[model samples]
Target: MPLKQPIGQKRLTNVAIVKYKKKGNWFETACYKNKVVDWRNGTETDLDEVLQTTAVFKNVSKGVLAKEKDLVDAFGTNDERAICTEILTRGDLQVSEKERKLEYENLFKGVATVLSEKCVDPNTNRPYTITMIERALKDVHFNVDPKKSAKVQAFGEALPLLQERFSIQRANMRLRLKLAAACKDEIQSRLAEHKVIVESKEADGATVAIVCQADPGLYQVLLALVRDLGKGHGHLEVVSLAVQREGMSGEGQASGDIQGILKEQQRASELSQVPYVTSQPASTTGRLRARSEEDSMAEVSYPRGPISGIPDDVTRKPMFLEIDGLQPGWEVELTKRGESGVVDAVFFSPSGEKVGAFVQARRAALSASKKAAAAQSTVE
Candidate 1:
């Protein structure tokens, strides 16, 4: 499991080693106790005494020392110290499975802690506990790469999966800002990085008005700016807020998630509302049985690949949807929450002789889209 621990020798404890390949020959170096030190920077005592061994080896785990001739040929020196320095500084460090597992676990929790502190429930505007974030991650079977930083991966890589199931959002505090005209330039400079919308030019000549979505910490800075610069002329109004996904419509508004999508005769229609659904989630365990061997579920666009992009790890609850035209035992199921909002519709047949399925979009989202377009046109 751990790169075949070279045969019968037990490697030394507290002595870290680097495995290097030079001119098709493998060499390993022994560094100071439990650390892979830079050979260029260590003091003379660290090289002479603390380093467990000066003899470079072909395999530390096997007790096989590198030959002098091979070392000279590969490194242009028979000197073990010089060769060891190059190998130690330039080579890859090998880690045991136990060590690797520990590092992996630490990094996984680090990512979770980062998310717990920086993100908030979009509904409640409160941070999720670390336990809750960790559970959601386990449900998604998230993999953490030891090479990447926990903070670096938290938003771009980890959060997307959690968002599909949880209500987590990177915290953004929506604040309504009003200040004396004299403080305008400084306030703008301070909040330039945040999502600041110039709400309106106020009727009073001496006042400036704006709406800014800022980090919770940034509120203190706003308070200070207004107190120090505006001379008690203005105040801050706080509103419920959460960070919106990039490229979504409006300043902080989210275009509604696709509740369901139906394709009838090669046409794709977006469904906004599920008029009727049972309290439980659908049981999507095995393959859906189709009407005929000649006609497969793949023929239709409703369910996406691998039984419709629904990963097996998601916590699924069974839900029942009713279709009017289906025969006595036949049924159509509409599932929600995974990948693209919904897993689309999977219709089952009772008799398998004459199987037909048709789905229609709920009109609320369609009507809203049209109304928004009309309002924008009128404004223009």
Candidate 2:
């Protein structure tokens, strides 16, 4: 006896079905057993063989044939159901293929654009070119997913691997930083966490000047830190750069060349812009102050406390008086002067608020004498 095939057993193959409208009634056209339906030409060859193998027709014997009502109920719209049926059954095959190809190409381009924008060449700090990105994609042999958008495919599958294969190198750079006195401690603490080398530090009054060497990537991190801690009052300038290294092996020669290049770059930068001269005070009030254009050019000075036992001249003159509670190094402008003299010591708060000022008695007297001489000369 021959082996029995299972009951209700059916051969399985991918089927293509098209729903279409005939007059006013909904109908479905199908290709079965891998039959090649010429969708573009609206032609079907081997109709007998296709009908014999079609799954839908096989189910017709079981009273499972779908009617126009079923199509309407499933799609909820005659137009939509008809269009779907037409696409499945007799839509232009060449046009559909072209659309699919266009979508795939568009996705590829989108992925390339994203990679270019998001990832940068580490050495140049610039984005990779489209060609370079394409080459990278090729190297990775990335597969494009028809169901997903190009950006999704690039980010999800290609970006990480491409970055790994075409990595960028970190550059060495020198930075001149002007930190607010209030945030000095915090900035210093954060800098200590990185491999930064402090070349010099100058504290005049409320402003501190810091010259340091670090990787270029760390500059962004420091900027964020400054903006947060200094409340937008901190400033930084790149003084020099040691771009992506060349293959020079001798330690001494490489060091000498690097130093020479840095000097040249620094000189060029200085010639292009005004140099920043920092003056930090001995103590700070922990408040950030804005620096005006005029203030940048102003000369910064500190007050000298009265010498011990050299009692202030009560009879000769009482010059400038010191204001308590004002942080040192605050910028001061002389606004008023005694009739005979010029103001001596002026003080300000970190936020540019004036504290107080005074003048010396001797200087007042000298100023009075000069006025007297000028008046006498005018009379003569």
Candidate 3:
């Protein structure tokens, strides 16, 4: 028997490949899997721990070394370490099948964690634990994508299914709004869309203060409503709120007198004359009547707010609201060229509750009326 050859130190036993392509050629590097991943995610910094050897290769799996001239041409350097760094930073990471499965499992956990934190069970009014969310996901067979973010997947995909399965919903946000007192009718439909506990309605000299708790999605819609309907004389202040409880009984109230995004062109004309409304402690309001008896507009009808200096041009085209732009719960108001003021458009479901039910009922009623009209066609 002869002496055995010396055993070389096998460092890169668990090798992972990272490859970069430049000038139609691939430059590859071998790195330790866990260390390279930790480095990529900013948790690891030691390059020595990440790299088995800083050797740049044409094909890492085949152990074919890259030529010095090609390396210089492709990466602008002949240094193996520099070329390796470039490859690792800018290249695609080649993970094994096992790593892909591991990453998908991680994504599942992340999405579950997010859903558990952001939503609540409607029946119990309590947050679902991570375990509960995970188990429910299994029962429903919810698929989590490894490529997407946890928050995105949780909200866009998981929440709707969770709602169907468990009736889970996001917690409500308490919001406060103030506009010209006469303008409240403009957005009454929108206000009725949620669980609005009338916190208070005061007529300040120029404004009416209204506070209520509602679904979180309504804030931006309400903002746009003020811009379009209130024309810049309204604002909603809701910097603080959490999940819904009994109602808007919390100590939180509107913080300040923030104004709405009034139209820039009308700012000088509309905002200056009207005193901006401010929320008092608990939204106690006392609005002065905005119209006077002698004003010609006051002669025609329902409550009208004083937005003076706006040109009264019936020459303006009659606005036809698009069906897509209408929200179901909002009360719609329309006026003719020569009509004196007002009566309610909606005679039923004034509280704005069960809007889906209200919609189905309204459709059925319309269908019946159409059929009766067809049946009663008297040719004479």
Query: Any runs in candidate 2 off by more than 4 Å, and if so which?
Result: 1-95, 146-155, 168-180, 191-380
Model 1, span 229-258: residue lDDT tens: 677777888864444321111111122221
Best by TM-score: 3
Error of 1 at 251 (Å): 31
TM-score: model 1 vs. ground truth:
0.41
After best superposition, candidate 2 residue 4: deviation in angstroms?
A: 60
| Candidate 1 colliding pairs | 280-318, 280-319, 281-317, 281-318, 281-319, 282-318, 282-319
Q: lDDT, candidate 2, residue 149? A: 57
List model 2 lDDT by residue over 196-282, tens digit each: 767798888898878887776688987787778767788888876543211111111222332332343233223324332111111
The sequence of per-residue lDDT tens digits that candidate 3 reaches over residues 240-330 is 3434221111011122111111121123122124433211111112111211211223232222221121134522112211111222222
For model 3, the stretches where C-alpha displacement exceeds 4 angstroms are 1-17, 29-91, 96-102, 178-182, 193-210, 229-234, 237-380
lDDT of 2 at 207: 81
lDDT of 1 at 333: 41
Q: How many residue pairs clash in each candidate?
A: 7, 14, 8
Stretches of candidate 1 exceeding 4 Å from the true structure: 1-11, 31-55, 62-64, 67-69, 76-90, 172-194, 197-380
lDDT of 2 at 144: 79
RMSD of 2: 28.8
